[model samples]
Target: MSIVLSDQDKSTLRAAAYGAVSLMAAATGSPQKAATNAAIALRSATGLVGHVLAANAKDIELKGKTVAELADRVLPALTAAMKLLGEQAPAEAGNFHGTILLAIEAAQIHPDKANAIAAEMARKITAALDAGVAPAAAAAGPDRPELQKAIEEIVDSGFVGVSLRVHDERGEWVGSAGTAELGGAAKPPTNGHHRIGSNTKTFTATLVLQLVAEGRFGLDDPVVKHLPEFGLDERITVRMLLQHTSGVFNFTGEVYEDGTIAPGIPIPYGTTGQEWLDNRFKTYRPQELVELALAKPARFEPGTGWSYSNTNYVLARLLIEKVTGCSYAEEMQRLILGPLGLSGTVVPDASPELPEPHAHAYYRHGDTTVDVTRQNPSWTSTGGDMISTTQDLHTFISALLGGKLLPAPLLTEMCTPHPTGIPNMDYGLGVFVVTTDGGGTVISHNGAAVGHAALMYSTPDGRKTLTAALNCVDDANLTIGAAFQNAQQRLVNEVFGGGQADPA
Candidate 1:
């Protein structure tokens, strides 16, 4: 039975509906301002149905706009609408028909909206299609029932969102589960862009190794020999910095066994939302981050023990800058991203904006939360500041293992592990050596910051691989951290088999 609207309710709806259409038309005169106001009005409305109407109305008014222009107008509407739907719907809002319907309708009515929606849809559908068409795609393709089950398990395990991409026996498969945010019905973009955290280390390491292959520096050379101003111990070599055995104190503060905090840079997790938001665009020099760590006592004497330190990689960034006389980003573009044709990867520098067609990422502080989805990544600096897609990451790892990046001898050296005493896990230069129970070994390096994580894995020879990007609510206590790790391991096993080792 149709739910009847009260007379007053119908009148309000009519007035509001007409007002929405008029606002869209008027705002079109100052397309920018109209777009802004339309976004604000749409945000104030409730439910997927309202969002659908608002988006439709806006799209109709903004006819003839470019895809980028339409996105600028529609995305805010989509974000606000998704947030409302996620909040109002029951926790077990099964099937997500409302969101799908709204999206389809928006695409059908407005050419601009249709273009934007179709572009995103294509990324997902093409990945699905490629799985069947490519000969090698069948190895780790997303069609595997086991792979789908693993993705479902992650969503079931309490993660707010997850997206996975794998390459193995069945080819390449990409899957996503959970809402983009806490109360949204739309699934996180299965191939959406995300900050790839310390996985940036592997990129940084690869660039440095590429220079090594070019005869820019030797692995055993002391870091102090290149940048002596920091007073690094001569024992700290380039290899140690890459391998995290350099004993450099982590500049982002460190937690000891007794739970004491050693202070360093003002990381986002430790600051007020407004403060972090304000400083988001500020540029941080690698030397500044390194000196900050140097001011503290070393985590241990150089090479005494192993500990994860963002400072080590920041130092590597400085080394790249000093030696090449180019910005770390420029070097990355020239050395890694450009050569590999990784168009999806970005070194944001002091820029806070993501390219077009991405999901919104947020941070909850207290009663007042903030939208930090567009903040400049300079705050993380070189440590965890790169953005990339699962596809690009998959290509990168596959290329690296396939001998497209490093030479055979150096790649071998890069994968050599120094045991960390964690069962089945060891630290290589910038990667991890993970031993599967079935006796197969996968080389990988995984990392996460506040809202993102990256997983890059390869068989020894780089013939089979898996890479993924995950976005979620990252908290200090790591409440859901274990589940993320577990899900990653399960996906790796399902694709690469339990006992296959890297052939390198």
Candidate 2:
């Protein structure tokens, strides 16, 4: 069965699944021991049910003064989860039922059924799971055809392929259009992984802020303290890096406001694209990327101006490694991916692989079109090298904005906007704070990497989100740049309450 659970529905499943274990733990009177054993069992679950239950538990909130009070909320949620899953995915409903039972069994302090109170709690849990639910009403949301039409319009605009996912009051809607490969008839996988380009900045920024939250470093501390080998400016603080106020030259290239372009590394564009294509598999260390940027004159004195510099995030990645004594990928997993159970997102350091079942991305150099899906992403490093699916993007943005990831004060700091000289949009830490034409606000970050690109946007509350992946024929000229911007505006208007204008 094809199932798309809304964020609310997912939240319900999390609460019900985790609460069931909490109830068993409470009954056992050895809450800590019982909870530990139950968690192991929950983590061991397999299949669709396993995926749902394993998401970041920070979103699961169970409020009650006593075990009885907790049961009142959890039992009903258990019934609700079953009803929703049964209507959408009957097989998954069975899996959910089985997983909870096993957890409760393992949670018992006396596994042989010697504890009367715990056994009684198990019976109550079983009864809730087995309770008959009313016939599910038709899902309340925009009909599928309308969403399908929206994406088809994007394909018509020139993209080779598009895969989109949106979560709103309509629950969840997903659709795809065009083709996975230029010459292939199959559509892009709705949940396929793709290079997330600069959206990796958001993840990198969050990691820095997380380290800050742990007191590892202060936002105002100079970058020199941790990464002294680079001899960075004393005025360049960690906050400046996260907010793009450091004025470091962009290693990708620089586009001055007067429409002048300065070259950086050879990339697929015009004739230079030929060189990039030939060297697509070559890897560059993060240090080398930073050195190249530093060799150029500072964009402006640190903290004196704002500029979008990929170099800033690469520096952030280096600092993360320095203070944590772990690689960027390791810290990412420990701090974010593992906690959130984001299995499809990858921080591919120097790796030239884009996992299986993904749409092919292509680039055109002169008259030759080549698949560039597996290029070494270390060229972009954390600035835009990570890979992820639309689903994981939704889970992440929703969790982060919903206050599950960062503490309140820090999240506020992350979202507060500074002028970026663009109309109606401003830069926040690693994200863009856009005030739509219709006067709505969204937190967003979009990225393009050669033939592949990804979009991530969400409301301030994170209750609504739009995430998408695109594959297209790209060249040095970025001929499709206009179409890419329009695609973003159209999807944002359709999914969020308003639309944004061109950055210019």
lDDT of each candidate versus the true structure: 0.63, 0.82
lDDT of 2 by residue, 1-504 (tens): 234788788899889999999999999978898887777657644445667777887889999999999999999998888788767654355446645765676687565347889988988998898672222212312255666787899899999999988777655565678999988888887667799899899999999999999999998999999898888999899999998899999998888889888888876764577889999999989999999999998889988899888899999999999998899999998988767756567888988988645899888877888999989998889889999878678878988999988999999999999988888899888889999877889999999999898999999999888889999999878898899998898888777756773241
Expressed as tens digits, the lDDT of each residue in 228-326 for candidate 1 is: 888889999999998888888898888777989876766666544345556766777676778888888887887878888888888999999989999
Q: Name the TM-score of candidate 2.
A: 0.76
Q: Candidate 1: where is the Cα deviation over 4 Å?
A: 1-142, 270-282, 497-504
TM-score of each: 0.70, 0.76
Instruction: Report lDDT (Cα) of residue 426, candidate 1.
Output: 82
CA displacement after TM-score superposition, residue 145 of candidate 1 (Å): 1.9
